[model samples]
Each structure stands twice: as C-alpha cells, then as structure tokens.
Target: MENLIIYPENQKQLQILKSLLEEMKIKFKSEEQVEELQDWQKEKILKGIKDIKEGKFSSNDDVSQKARECIK
Candidate 1:
C-alpha cells in the first residue's frame, strides 16, 4: 500500500482526476485536511458563498474566453 497527496488547483481538475481514477478502477480514498480556519479566512469563505448565491461568480467558460481575448 502506498499513500500520496494530490492537491488539485480547482474543482474541474479534481473531477477529471476522479473520472480517470474510476475508469481505471483504482482504489482510492479522499480526505480533506482538517485545520482550524482563521477568522479572516472564514469571513472570506462566507462572503464568497454569498456572492455565489447572488450570482456574482464567473463560470469557467467566461474566464477562459476573457483569457483568450487578452491573448489576442
């Protein structure tokens, strides 16, 4: 048995890795790091959630399109 840590940058990458793992039938378990968040970190996360609920977040496609426009 071997243990490895995988830190995916974002949810999309995480999903892709999960799909590949499933396709390959690899046995794996996911564990989120347990840590106490600072007061500021908690506030920031709450604000982000509120913004998402208020439809203030941009989608992946929107960000990618903006990046392409900047590159052009």
Candidate 2:
C-alpha cells in the first residue's frame, strides 16, 4: 500500500482527520509520533539557515535569470 502524508492547518482540522481515519479503520501516525529527522537532514537544514543568515543565498531574480539562460 502507498503511504500518504496530510498536513492539517488547525486543531479542528486535525481532530476531523483523526476521527475520519479512525472511523475508516485506516492506520496512520501523527507528526508527533513519527521518527525525528536524521542527522544529515538536520545538518543540511542548519546549514541552509546559516547561509540565509549570512546572505549567502541567491535572490529570486538571480535564480530566474539563471533558469532562463539554461532554457535558451
């Protein structure tokens, strides 16, 4: 069986989803119950945040220009 992930925007939506899944007898796990991020994932996220703070990332216009050049 394929797996699916759902993000409920609010507590009401989360409750509704939980209730619906229970009623349907479909097994599912909440975000809190899921495994934590791997070490590499955490490191990559931290590096990205550091890069943003250091202004090491490209701007939207720069990225778009590069994409257009690539497509030419």
Instruction: Please state the error at residue 22 of candidate 2 in Å.
Output: 5.4
lDDT, model 1: 0.91
Report every candidate's CA lDDT: 0.91, 0.94
Q: What is the C-alpha RMSD of each candidate to the true structure, in Å?
A: 14.1, 8.3
Structural similarity to truth (TM-score) of each candidate: 0.50, 0.57
Candidate 2 lDDT (Cα, whole model)?
0.94
What range of 10 consecutive residues in model 2 has the weakest lDDT sum?
1-10
User: Clash pairs of candidate 2?
Assistant: none
Q: Which candidate is the best by TM-score?
A: 2
What TM-score does candidate 1 reach?
Answer: 0.50
- Superposition-based RMSD of candidate 1 using all C-alpha atoms, in angstroms: 14.1
Model 1, 1-72: lDDT tens digits are 777779999999999998999999986667654567999999999999999999999999999999999999
